[model samples]
Target: MNNILNIVKHIEKSIIFILIVFLVAILVVSVVDFGLYFSRLLFYSSLEGWYEPEFLMPLFSSFLIVLIGIELLETIKAYLKDDSIHVELVILVAIIALARKIIVLDYSTMKPEKLYGLAGLILSLSVAYFLIKSAGISMKLRKKSSVDQK
Candidate 1:
């Protein structure tokens, strides 16, 4: 039984390692893509001799994509460190993704109701993140107090 458990544990670790490698590869590609996209935007703007307001959304979106990728990498790192995924980090990633959408969204193209829906979604995620964070803090405090009593 112990040997079987050890084998299972090894398999799990291998899978996680594989995932991390793939994620790192993806992160590297994302960084390169971000740089290329940003540089192209700047180069074109320089050639045109002036920046355009239309480019603002794309620029912000690209930046946010890189930021989201970094956050995801952090989540994987945290998981590796603790052997568990953190809910707060996941929620943060979700929030960042939503923000990215908002940044790139064409308000004129979207309906008013859709915008309201996004607003509500953001609010819900924010509340959930807060609750999860507070719960984690309370759990740590409880653990500490229990240890002290013991």
Candidate 2:
């Protein structure tokens, strides 16, 4: 039984390793793609006009995509270290995803209610993130105080 359990553990570790490697590859590809796209946008803007406001939204969206990938990588790292997923990290990823949407929003076409919905979403995520961080800090302080008292 122990040998079978050991085998299972090894397989799990191997799968995680492969996943990490794939994520790193994805991260690299995303960064390279962002660079290429931004350069092309800049080159075209330079040739056509001194300023192009339209390209800025796409650039920010791409940048946020890269950031989301990075946050996933961090979540994986945290899981490997502690064998648990961190809620704060997941919330952060969601916030980044929502921020990306807001950043790329076409104000001319979007409805006012949709804008209000997005604003509410951002506010909720901000509050959740703050509460989680504060809870963690309080827990750590409690643990330290208890240890000192003992």
Q: Pick the candidate with the highest TM-score.
A: 1
Question: lDDT per residue, candidate 2, 10-128, as tens digits?
Answer: 68668888899999999999999999998887676564643455757778888999999999899878767665677788889999999998888779999999999999999999998
Candidate 1 regions with alpha-carbon error over 4 angstroms: 47-51, 134-150
lDDT (10s digit) by residue, model 1, range 1-150: 656766776797788888889888987887788888888877765646335657666767778887898888888777666666777788899999999998778787899999999999999999988997877652211112222344
Best candidate according to lDDT? 2
- Where is model 2 more than 4 Å wrong at Cα? 1-6, 47-52, 136-150
TM-score of each: 0.78, 0.77
Which pairs of residues collide in model 2?
none
lDDT, candidates in the order shown = 0.77, 0.80
